[model samples]
Target: MSQPGPGSNHAPPAARTSPESGPPFSEAGGIPVDAATPVTTFSPVVLEVPGRPVDLRMKVSAPATGDNLPVILFSHGHGPSNFVSSLHGYGPVVDFWAAHGFVVIQPTHLDAMMLGLREADDPDAPAYARSRVEDMRHVLDHLDQVEAAVPGLAGRLDRSRIAAVGHSMGGHTVGVLAGQSTADPADGSDLDLSDDRVKAAVLLAAPGHGEDLAPAVAEHYPALKATAFHGMTTPALVVVGDKDWNAHFSQRRDWHCDAYSRSPGPKSLLTLFGAEHGLGGISSYDAKETTDENPERVAALRALVWAYLRSALYPGDRAWADATAALAAMATPVGAVESK
Candidate 1:
């Protein structure tokens, strides 16, 4: 697919911040450290969203294995859980990425953080989705501050190569963060896209919460309805399974494939063979256990994720893609392999 170049949609990088000027992941909710530690200390922060203090958990990556590693700002799936989903809930995806050489930060958009006193008063009020996206920006800004605090951290993070990856509601959040505007999930209204810090995004099983996929009636998020993500122009990749109930996995796959086709930049889609809504099959901590059950399947899926991450983090590297493609195709019947 045609992935978007550095300067595709939105304003030029000059309009954004430059390395000499400031830090890239700063404002966003990430911390930067110089020492060699696997996990940075956790700091509780309160971000102001329309005069409201939103609680957030922030952390930075340990020392990188290579020089000038790319940064990935991850948004966890919106379940009752916090950023835990990105860390321990799902497979060791985040850990794998970190081990490979990428700074990963996950923001937990707890409803309590934004609901405030009105949470009980407005029983019918829709949960704030926009706030979640903005929170991501806050995390980035915080990372920028970390750079200011610690030297040699400024240029290490390449904001231009930054990417946003999310699952479920988090996927939708990344969509909005990357410029995919849709109607509000609660009311049929347009959503605001004020903060466009994310340059590229990867949507995994993104829910069409407010979509009217059913011809008769359309669901919408009043605060976010009537909004359409235009000129996203950033390179994106959308992955989905075949058994996910939310988007019927297959439907989601088709939707993402179409989205990639419409995107201004290069894009690709990978449908896990018989995968389900919950990556229960592949998202596991025990690589050995999963591999034991189906080594071929696990290997293929790992190659897929590793290849994509490699390309996304280090653009212009086609070797990873080539190797992964060969690995994936090596297995029999294209989409018949088990995820686990």
Candidate 2:
């Protein structure tokens, strides 16, 4: 994979000191904030999947200048949200990854609340979880066209270094791509949707196994009963909030860490001190969904995830090492990292 070479021209503007004066900025892990590459975004890059009812629309963001840039396929979480589930959400993480030398492609899944489609509307609606995985696969299959749709991004992506990231239900979406297996709830047959193309993954506040789910979850999201992670062999980092207790999902908040504990080796877990499902407002700048709206926390999360991605993709990069060390060295650490 091509790494960021030394050049001041790619640097983003210095972060402002006054909180009220400008947008909040977080320090980049391993790389100096001013030394990271600038970003450019192209939105609503539409692609059609044969036999699908709706065209897949995506938002692509990349460094303003660079070649062989790594790709991050981000899946937006399902919510009663309108625009967030579309190509318009998660600006915070998407922009950060792009500005720091990644090509982030975010696709709106069919389960998006914005679509206002109901399970009773179609046979596939009951298989929304599976569709999320297929949406990502479609994105990979049409990477050439997606890149072509965005000027200056064409021919600049490193296809070998792709990572899948998701939040909430989106987490389950990327989990499947990362090797987690599930059974079709309707037929009780194994559903192996893993994609080898995704070299790494990050699951944020993802759901746990079905057997351990809270009673409410089993009653409502019955499809989760088939979730299984024993096959999630890809290198991944699972980030969960210490306070992200979803009474409707699991009896215990730590249940969210199943993706880390149950997955095979070469995995890491990040336990954020006071974070919730939103993980310090990663979904948006100031969306009401963020119960813990700490910019500092969001910054740390971004840096740590970026560092892990850097190390996992490049092999020789010590970004993860430096980032973990930085976190450990903090006088009052915001989180803890453990790997096996």
lDDT of 1 by residue, 1-340 (tens): 2111100111111232333844332110111112233533233333444644434544454344455666777765533322234334444456545555666665555442232321433322233466667678777777766555443445676665667877655666777776676544445466555345565577766654333232211222243233243544556667665544332222233443333444455666666655544343233443221212233344444445555666666669773456444545553532322111
**Model 2 TM-score (2 dp):** 0.89
Residue 291's lDDT within candidate 1 is 15
In candidate 2, position 232 carries an lDDT of 94
Cα lDDT tens digits, model 2, 118-149, are 35465345337777798999999999899889
Check candidate 2 and list the clashing pairs: none
Model 2's lDDT to the true fold?
0.79
Best by lDDT: 2
Please give the lDDT score at residue 104 for candidate 2: 96
